[model samples]
Target chain A: MRIGLLKRHSAVFIVYVILAILILTTGLLSDVFLTFRNLENLLRQVAPLGFVSVGQTFAILTAGIDLSIGSVVSMTSVLTTGMIEGQQQLVLPVLVLVFGLAILIGFINGTIISKTGVHPLIVTLGMMSVVQGGILLYTKAPTGSVPISYDFVAWGNVWKIPFPILLFASVATIAIIFLRLTVFGRYVYATGGNEEVARLSGIKTGRVKTIVYMICSFTAALTGIMLASRMGMGDPLVGERYMLDSIIPVLIGGTRLTGGVGGVAGTIGGIFIFIILSNALNLLDVTAYWQWIVEGLVVIVSVSLYFRQKR
Target chain B: MQVAVSKRLQRSPQHIRSLFERFGIYIFLAILIVTASLVSPNFLKPQNLKDILNQSAALGMVAIGQTFVILIGGGGLDLSVASVMSTVAVIMAHNTEGQNSLFIPVMGVCLLFGIIVGFINGTLITKRKVQPFMATLGMMIIVQGIRFLYTKGMPKGEFPPIQRYLATGDIGSVPTSIISLAVMVIIALFVLRKTTFGRKVYAIGGNVNTARLCGYNIDFTIISVYMISGFMASIAGLYLAGWIGISDNWVGKGYELDSIAAVVMGGTTFEGGRGGVLGTIVGVLIVMMLYNIVLLLGMPVQMQFVVKGVVIILATSFYASFRRTQT
Candidate 1:
């Protein structure tokens, strides 16, 4: 009976095992992989994605997707970096701008999708192109840099823990609380699990969808700001890779693409597993081209395993 | 008197709707043509017209493929089509490097690859019960990786003589690429309108549950449609390779979006069911024409994306409004 229970819960167990394997492999393969500096750097690298995926979790919980998140990240990164442009005093205002734009973009996505009754994919796909174009037109070419002080958010430590990891943890905590304790959180699950029934039960389906989309865009924007600080420059193409990376981790974490389930905790583990694997691969001196192949294979296997377990 | 007035009001709205539905594509095409002509004197010239048609041929072929997948409902998207195209192009170029007689073998391999990829997509979605978006997105990433791995991150080899001839050589006054595009569109039209498989596809899209109850082989039909799409995508890639005289990794970057936009603009609803090849052809022409007009106007390449983005939004909104009024 205990063995059967263990088998049933093996998906979650797999994440821990993978993480342990990654650590052991990396420790054996490269001197740099186990270093505190490298660990800190990895945390900083994964932080922005962690933030974006948290918001993605909310949207996915409602059985929708936000392709526009990557674009939002790019736009915010550009706008914030361009605004701050070595002006130390302008950092706070730039941060505010990022937040405002995130909310506005999120609101628009939510409103248009929920009100028109269009599929989230098409709407978000269109918005992705629109925002990408907006960034391209706005930047003309990638040319802006933030001062070193802004990097404090990305690189600083709070009593030995990296600030970026701290940010990720805080965001994850808030998301968990929201999902567990709030009316909106329950509504998200209900809506995702069965939209028609939720509607029949007096849930404002449109409002719920809108809020979810808004949250996604908002999180993406925040991540964008942090990434800009980390990179110290705005590249129009910077966040393009995040769109797929963010989703892959969520899927790896056992979030059904069909939505209505999964949480931030599993997503965190998924992110850590991915980051460790990637870092280990890099440490082993794998070529970039081969890395892509390996990464893709990992996703395919992980997702197939996830489905197999579900069945 | 009251009945007469009410009937007239209803008839007028219906008239307007029909006009919008039937002539809207033509209107967009005319506007693009006029705008292109106004922007550049070279736009209306035969040479430029030939160039535009040749350029659009590949995109048009892919869009036709996309129309089939979208018509099957289930929010079916095939991002792997572009990657599949690249893979086929690479295989064709590599195997038929110099042998003129090896064209048949190359084409056969490309077709088999398409079938395999499409089968995987279909099986995963239908048998494993994966969402179409997730399945195809995974396939897209996988196919791209395979292509990159096979080529070692750089496209290798060269197109054989016959393949190059098919891409660039003309038949009388018509470009071979254009001819190929026309042939594909015709074949697709025939499949959509006259075949049992095609009818089943529409029925499934219209309502899967009803179609299943009616004893349609849902799995086979869905798989076949995706296979058709994958085959068309490879054909497009082959033509693309021939036309460009070189195959490259980035040959079909973001093409899935372009194909989807063309399909959507062609009046196929993303929700699926009612759409036709006739509209899709016009949609392809309109999109191609827009690109040409943007180029002619000397607008930056970025502007092309902006225009496409706006067109997609407008097209969907128009469709949504039209549906509301119709119901």
Candidate 2:
């Protein structure tokens, strides 16, 4: 029975093993890799994607993709910083506006997919284009600054841990619990596992999916805010790569791209693996160009591994 | 009496919906043309028409490639095509450097790269079982990175006059580019509509398992489809290099999405095996005209992106609804 269980859960098991191997390899390859400073910095850098991955986990859980996450991040970064403009007093209002816009975008995405039966990829692709254009129309150049007060969230530390890491941990914990221990979570799994069967089982599959999308955009918005805080400026192009980057972690961490077979714990491991891999590259003096090759190879290999495990 | 009239209107929407699928984009293209002529007297001039056709030729080639992959279905998409175009543009420009002696070799290399990339993409998806989206997406990222590394973020070189003439120069008052494009389209339509391979493509797209069961070499067919896509992208890249008179890393930035929009808008169902090359060309023409309209109206350049986005959403939704009704 135990052997059979291990066989079934082998993908997640492999991810953990991979994570461990990455840690050991990096540590042996670079003296600083095992140090607290490097670890903390890695966690801090992983924060934005960490949060985004949690939300992506939900979307993928429902057999849908959220391509607009990157655009949402871009829009949110622009909106938050553009509105704040270094004014501490406007931070709250700007955040509210950003989240509200994110929610609205999510609603539009979910409703259209649900009502029209158009594929989520196309719907989100359209949304990405609209948001991207909106960002350009709003400003051809990077505009506005994040308030200095917001630095606490981006750079602050508590109990020797950076706040972003703390934020990611908190979000991941709640998500893991929500997905593993709740009725709605099960519905999400059911919907993704087999939508037709889920519907016949009386699940409000549409609502479940719509809510999942909302969660996705909400987290992405939060990541954007965090990114703006870190950079202290709003740049339209900053979020262009996040959509691809976020999906990688989810896929590598054993969250099935086909949906219904993964969770937050696996995603956390995925994020760690990515962070360590990138850090290793940086430590080994790899240039930005070579990093791309390595990243692509990693995706191909990890995905292939996933398929092999399933077989 | 009011209910009867309302009922009649409601019933006509179904008629209207099908009409839109079959000819809506063409109608929109016509309306836009009329509107453009009314807005700017220069619009109907031969020079302007030539400019539009020239631009469409470059974009249309890419769309044809996109249509093929999407037609082959099974979540088929070629995200790397645009990136491949960019890389080839750089390679050709840098290697040839306006030297006629070097042109043939560079062209050969570019086409070779296209085939290699397409083969890799096909193998990754089919043999490795990576989702098509993920495979192409990974390739796109990797290729872009490689290009950046090769160019060091700055692309240099120019198209030789001979190449330039093919792209923009006219031959006896007829643009060679458009003529070439017309011939290519004719060839594509013939192959897609008349050949055994075309039938196999449709069979796999309509249902992959059924196609496999019917003894079609599913893997070979899919790989060939992507190879065609890659080759078409290389052609677009060459034309764009000549048309723009420069080679840059950013040249192919948005062609993937634009090609997808064109294919979907052309009534080629995303579910595949339902549309043809002729419709895609018309779709490309519609997109081309929309850009012209923006220029004529002097609208913010960004508004074109917005308009394109909205059009994609509306077009896809309309098609999906129509398909749903048919089923």
Note the Cα lDDT for every prediction shown: 0.81, 0.85
User: Model 2, A206-231: lDDT tens per residue?
Assistant: 89988998999999998998989999
Pairs with steric clashes in candidate 1? none
Show where candidate 2 strays beyond 4 Å. B1-20, B31-43
Q: Best by TM-score, which number?
A: 2
Over the true interface residues, superposed, what is the Cα RMSD of model 2?
1.5
lDDT of 1 by residue, B1-327 (tens): 457555766777686665565556667777778877887898999998998889888888888888999999987778788988888989887788757899988899998898888888888878876667667777887888788878887777888889889989999999999888888888888888899878988898899999999999999988887887788888888888788888688666777877887777777776678787767878888777777777878887777766776666666666556555665
Measured with C-alpha atoms, the lDDT of residue A110 in candidate 2 is 87
Q: How accurate locally is residue A181 in candidate 2, as Cα lDDT from 0 to 100?
A: 95
Best by DockQ: 2
Q: TM-score of A-chain in each prediction?
A: 0.94, 0.97
Model 1, position B9: C-alpha lDDT score: 61
Q: What is chain B's TM-score across the candidates, in the order shown? A: 0.92, 0.91
Candidate 1, A73-102: lDDT as tens digits: 999889988888888899888888788888
Backbone collision count in every prediction?
0, 0
**Candidate 2, DockQ to 2 decimals?**
0.64
Candidate 2 structure quality by residue, lDDT tens digits, B27-89: 766776888899988789998888889899878998998888999987888988889989999
